[model samples]
Target: MKATNEIKPRLDVVSRAITSIVEGVCKENDFDIQYSGIESTDGLPVRQLPAIWDALKTAKARMNHQMNQLISRITHRWNLASSIHRLPAEVLAIIFQEFEPIPGHPDGDSSLLNLLLVLRAWYDAITGSPQLWRSFGAHTPYNIARLVVDHSKALPISVDWRPPREPPKRDLGKVLDLAIENSARVKSLTASVPHEGDPHL
Candidate 1:
């Protein structure tokens, strides 16, 4: 029973590895999968066209080649192979800090936070590091204000508000007020007001 249990786990691992390799190759090569049905000569449906069938054959061959190469490399480097997931939390945090976070990223900074929250070691390592949070900036929307407050780090703040081409009943004061309200830490403000051949500072 013990031997069988161990063998089962190994088989499961191998199966997952094979599946991953196959899928990875397919994705890299932009392979598409299709299903087909055999048909009779008597005006019955025939197998899928050359496009779908040929793509499947090519994809399978490519997948097998990739998996074989991966296996060879793993066997050659087995002694030095170490799972990335098992790396020291601090090292992983430093590695992750290399990726910049886009303001509208679907996962947001929450994605990195979730990764750090995976274990106590990661939490301590990530939370103790400040570089990971440096990417929180103006382009991140209103969430940046919260992040700055949480960090208690003063950032060089700049606000640029372009006023209308024609001055209305009210002047740039309203626009400046809005900028202040939104970005209280703003150290420098630049704005464009109506020219009308007149310049005011």
Candidate 2:
């Protein structure tokens, strides 16, 4: 019927528009099409897509065996390209860097380190990146101390002691000692004493 023909094309357009909007939302949310196996980027259960299933049903009814074969080939290619290991080291590192560790995101440092354990390639690239190491201050008795030791000779040193809810765990005297220790080499020195009641130090 002519009426059915016009409605079918309009329905197809609506389905495609919905698909495009869902894809955009996923990308903005930092999720990929391959994030979960069955679902598409829009969180749609692939099985429930009436348009896609209808097309397959139509092909089957028409005895279009080649359509199934084509679908299999496309699925294979998609799986290979979407593998996390297929990503370049530089690209992965950049993605990891997006979750920067700061007061706002205290657990970011540990999370990035955990991500490094996923595979040898991620571990090597993350550990080897200097930009990743720069955020962890040398004052913290962590491995970043080496970077501070090496760069302290020329770089300006700024230390901010932000204690948790309790009183200052690190003594003010110790911070003053560090300032004096690098007084000759540091171009600028900044030290923050957390007020007894202030949340923003």
lDDT score of model 2?
Answer: 0.51
Candidate 1 per-residue lDDT, tens place, 112-186, comes to: 556654555566666665556543322233444345334434544445444332332243454344445646666
Give the TM-scores of the predictions, in the order they appear: 0.31, 0.37
Q: Can you write out model 2's per-residue Cα lDDT over 72-98, one digit (the tens) per residue?
A: 788667655666768888888798776
Which structure among the candidates has the greatest lDDT? 2
Q: After superposition, how far is residue 55 of candidate 1 from its true place, in Å?
A: 61
The 10 consecutive residues of candidate 1 with the worst lDDT sum are 35-44
Q: Specify the poorest-scoring 10-residue window by lDDT in model 2.
A: 99-108
Question: After superposition, which runs of candidate 1 have C-alpha atoms over 4 Å from their true positions?
Answer: 1-86, 98-100, 103-110, 137-145, 148-201
Compute the lDDT of residue 176 as modeled in candidate 1.
Answer: 41
Please tell me which predicted candidate would have the highest TM-score against the true structure.
2
